[model samples]
Target: MPPRTIGEEFTKGLWHENPIFRQLLGMCPTLAVTNAVINGIAMGLATTFVLIFSSIVVSSIKKLIPNQVRIASYIVVIATFVTMADRFLAAFFPLISKDLGPYVPLIVVNCIILGRQEAFSSKNSVGRSFIDALGMSAGFILALLILSSIREILGAGTFLGHQFLGSWFEPWVIMILPPGAFITLGILIALTFVIEHKIKQRR
Candidate 1:
């Protein structure tokens, strides 16, 4: 069926139901990875791969799974993908993998992927579910990029590893620290709400 094609399933994960900005899923990795551009991108792609495949598998077998066992099933599926991603990164880029630490494994617990399995993927054909997963992944990546870019520039006086700040620019040491991540994300959330409120008023 046209509605159940792979393209439709994949694109939604890129934008419409974006797991980060729209669905508010997977906040942990989004916040943690944006410290550096490389980290943010790597985390995003890794999550996207996990989400897309999990959706495919879950949707494919939705009819076979019992209602009571769905949550456990979804988590096991997610954990498998996370392990693959973690191992892949460790083998190719040991430094980044070390920096990411246990967070890669923690993707198994990412609320976004599980939420999609329950709220969208389980009820849809495999094709549509895949798109939703992809859209969510894109959205998550976008959010991470925005947050990480802001933090990196203001905190380190650099963007993507390049120095943009003059000597007069005082880098906020806190930006790279864990506390800074919390504060920055908090402010961004507030700003997002303010903009949303303004947009609603216009509509």
Candidate 2:
């Protein structure tokens, strides 16, 4: 592998280090709200906001926090952002917020967000941390979008509440169920590995 440039850091999470397919972090919301496209998108954006801001803040204040208490400090920072995001969504997007349920509050403990803070942000410069956050958030959102699109279209025969399939097409009730979430995610993960392997072979 070549030495990584700053650009690589920002772009790798799109596929190479995707939080869902690669790292397999934050499975709670990934599986819980992905029954519908709108719910998935709402959860993704809310998580993105929390992840980015928390990374920025954690990186900026890393030095000031003691090693023993760094994890606690990081949680506080993450929780603050999560609270803000939760309230913001509730205020403006009540319907989506309701649909998302407790998953939004659960972002404070999401492994993807806290993992980056502990592994990257706590040691890196603010700029690098921000880029990492951006990449991770983008990857997360993309994963949610793809998963939700597959689920909603097949399960409900709709895309964001708009019917896409003709009357001839019957909805797959299983696609909207828990088993469907696992099955879809499993297939996507396998497909991701195959693509990555092919790319590696090409190189």
Q: Highest lDDT, which number? A: 2
For all predicted structures, in order, the TM-scores are 0.88, 0.97
Candidate 2 lDDT by residue in tens digits, 134-175 = 999999999999999999999999999999999899999999
TM-score of 2: 0.97
118-181, model 1: which lDDT tens digit per residue?
Answer: 9988999887787687777777777788888888888899888899788899999889878878
Model 2 clash pairs are none
RMSD (Å) per prediction: 3.1, 1.1
Model 2 regions more than 4 Å off: 1-3
Query: Model 1: residues >4 Å from true position, as ranges?
Result: 1-18
In Å, residue 65's CA in model 2 sits off its true spot by: 0.9
The model with the greatest TM-score is 2
